[model samples]
Target: MKMLEGKVALVTGGGQGVGQGIALALAAEGAHVAVAGRTLATLEQTCGQITQRGGRALAVTCDVMDAGDIERCVSEVVDTLGGLNILVNNAQIVPLGRILDVTDEEFGKGLDSGPVATLRLMRACYPHLKGDGAVINLASSAAVRWDASGYGHYAATKEAIRALSRGAACEWGPDGIRVNVIAPHALSPGLRGWMEACPEEAAAFVRSIPLGRVGDCEDDIGRTVAFLVSDHARYLTGATIPLDGGQAYWG
Candidate 1:
């Protein structure tokens, strides 16, 4: 049988990039997925792809910064998909700049899009999540490795998510709800833009990895998320799994 057969999943930022990949992956695993994001077009595209592949999916318009949107999103997913079995918190506004160059507004933007939204989503989904339900929060290698050039705010929020996931794991484990973080080095739209602007640096970064390659959004990161939400990972919780192709390690 398919690993996630009969499961219902919700993926934030599911309009594009890693979130889109994850939504499609979950659907491929026999789960009906709700692709939530602010953009209706992109969400529809993701859902369309899933439906074309004979998987069930729904496009939910949601702005993570809005509390009402978050609440409504969880409700819509449950209403449309029957029940919420998995939640993937994969949306974030990535701010790139040296620490000294970042302003309060810029830092706040990162927090609002990342940890704050993650926390709100978790709380919104808490009551709906039954025993064996799973949550996969996205983290980053920047947080684990601390590059120190750019990604200061991004790293901070990601680490915050890791901490929050650990807390949730402890608090919700007995209830059969598993919470974990995935630090991915997948090729995202932001990463693609960076590579185009600084091809040499991007190449060097790839070379530095022991695996000699970065990760693919759908194939690498998405599959890891699928595993995490499956019964195969039933014993796992509060762990940070690095999906960076040997670029970084986390204990």
Candidate 2:
């Protein structure tokens, strides 16, 4: 039997990148997935891919910054898939700017999009999550160490997510719910943009990693997420698993 057979998974930011990868991976494991994102077209694309592969999935339009959107998304997941057993908070926005260049508005946007949205989604899914349910928060290697100059805001938000995941695990473990964070260093489509935006710095950043190769989206980070939400990680909780291919270790 598949690892997540008959389970229902709700993944935010499932329209693309790591979120899309995670949604597809979960569906491959026999779980019904709700692909939630602000873009209906992108969400539909992800949903279509799942269904075409003989998996069940639904596209849900959600803006993580909005509480109502999150609540509605969770409700739809339960209503459509029967129950919620896995919740992956993967939606985030990265605004590149130096610390002095970052405005209060931009800082607020980053915070709201990252850790704040993660906390809101967790709270929305808490009541529907059954015993043994899993919550996986998508974090980043930026939280583990400082690399670039303009990513302090982004790193701070991810760090908050890591701490939040640990706190939630400790509080919710008694209820048989596992909460964990995955700090990925994968080559998603966004990687090109990030690299191109700062080529010299990006190259320098890659040189710091021992693996010498950036990770692939689905095979690297997605697999880690899949495993964390499966029975294979039943004994794991409150842990931050680094999928950076030794980047964090070398740093």
Show how many residue pairs clash in every candidate, following the order shown: 0, 0
lDDT of 2 by residue, 1-251 (tens): 99999999999889888888889899988989998999999999999999999999999999998888888888888888788999999998775678899888888888888999999999989987758799999777765465567778888888899889999999999888999988887777788688889999899978977888787767777777888999999999999888887878524
| lDDT accuracy of residue 125 in candidate 2 | 91
Instruction: Encode model 1's per-residue lDDT on 1-251: one tens digit a residue.
Output: 89999999999999888998898889889999999898999999999999999999999999898899999989989987888989999888887788898888988988998999999999999987868799999988886564567877778988998999999999999888999999888788878999999999999999978988878889888888999999999999999888888877564
The residue-level lDDT of candidate 2 at 193 comes to 86
Work out how many backbone clashes candidate 2 has: 0
RMSD for all candidates, in order, please.
1.2, 1.9
Among these predicted structures, which one has the highest TM-score?
1
Q: List the residue pairs that clash in candidate 1.
A: none
Task: Estimate TM-scores for all models.
Answer: 0.96, 0.93
